[model samples]
Target: MTTARRGRPGYDLESLLQVAVKLFNERGYDGTSMEDLSRKLGITKSAIYHHVPSKEELLRLSVDRALDGLFEVAASTEQLDGRAIDRLEHLVRGSVLVLADRLPFVTLLLRVRGNTKVERSALARRREFDRLVTDLVKQAEAEGDVRPDIDPAVAARLLFGTVNSLIEWYRPRRGSSGAELADAVCKMAFDGLRA
Candidate 1:
């Protein structure tokens, strides 16, 4: 009398987040709707509600996935005993690995424009991460490893901007591994910024 559940399997929160991030990246978060997600998922909007109360909660989860990984790297890299410049390099490499591993989530995070409470919270976290990098850059400058001519905040932005730019063109399956690409980034960026 009973048949097996076949077709598309039930989506867990993780799987739902993955598809949501992909759609958010493709259509921009502001443009995407619960209806669109329900259509794509072959599930009703009420089914999605079973996982999360609202679309904004979904955005918060997706962006938090990215911010959590990034903060983990920043925290671990800070604890390493070495020159500030070396620690910064480690942070960059770890961040690239995060981007490659969670490309879709990071992509969605990068596109956030603070249009909602969730987006504003994400932006606040992003600014906190940027401050961490800026502090490290200032440490490197104080150690005489970084150039004194540039503002540490500017240097931090430029270095991380190069890393973040990967979202525009870098694919996980591209010719280089994340570590390889990170090496190239550090080599090019640090070479120019070093005193």
Candidate 2:
């Protein structure tokens, strides 16, 4: 067997996590093994262990990165300080940006089936984010910015469903940016929902 390269100065934890996340996205968290990761990184399994304790830890870290991006947007001053309708729009646009920027991590997050403890935790956090958006929808409805005819919970689900579906088919166009795509989502979502 060819011993993989060793002592590469650039193989830090962050870079290793990126490779691990990409592999997880491709092969799935449950299907991927440390051996597969080592082979893909061209490093020994020992080298990978030096960065993370185990594959589950890597999965936790990756999903956390995706979750953090979302929570940060929800907690941002812009998201908190606006009209309920505008704040909801900011959250939707921010989610699209996160999905575009961290496509692999977000994709893995969305596909997690709760088979592991890490995956279950990720799902719980996702539900919490959904609740926050639901609250925003309710506030918008109360403020008359959003139509009161639709249930807030259902509206939030549909709104996020549209945004989350980006993970399935979004690809980077040559000139279009995440912001541009987010603008389109906000326009399409709000134009119909706004009262």
Candidate 3:
């Protein structure tokens, strides 16, 4: 049995987060003020404060949500134990699902420019995630699974540049399911890179 969370009648953390992400995506974080969130949410600033300590807290939560999802996929036992190429594929597929399921959070995350401490922290996490991908690419190349000519870092960026492009036009309830999209990405990305 679980007790219900107590909060103001209309707005909760989740809803606030949803609106905040939307506004952040639309107006840019620096451009979107607490006033904007309060107005768009049809609530007072103090009401928003009740849910989050500050606007930066909201930014931290949203970006962390996206980063945490990707890191979870990267750290999975399946991802850890596979051949490097296979593990890379698992990482890509799981990342696509993460982007699809948490589209808004991921969008806000990708748009971060390191303008503030929260953005800087998010960028650091992004770099760590990139390092994981680059290491895998190098391992795969060493194993003769990936092409030798390409730099591992370049290959890693290209692979994820493809995955990250999905955020540009992908919309839920469109024709492609996340699994189908992941399969397409894997086929397109791996076929060309595989040696």
In order, what lDDT does every prediction score?
0.89, 0.89, 0.89
The per-prediction CA RMSD against the true structure, in angstroms, equals 3.2, 2.5, 5.1
Question: Model 2, which residues run further than 4 Å from truth?
Answer: 6-10, 77-79, 193-195
Worst 10 residues of 2 by lDDT: 1-10
Residues 1-195, model 3: lDDT tens digits:
012223435877998898899999999999999989887877788878888999999999999989999999988924377589999999999999999889999999999999999999999999999999999899999989999988899999999999999999989886779998888889899985456
In candidate 1, stretches whose alpha carbon ends up further than 4 angstroms from where it belongs are 1-6, 192-195
Candidate 3 wrongly placed segments (more than 4 Å):
1-9, 77-79, 193-195
Candidate 1: worst-modelled 10 consecutive residues by lDDT:
1-10
How does model 1 score by TM-score?
0.92
Q: What's the lDDT for residue 154 in model 1?
A: 95
- Residue pairs of candidate 1 with colliding backbone atoms: none
Model 1 residue 103 lDDT score: 88
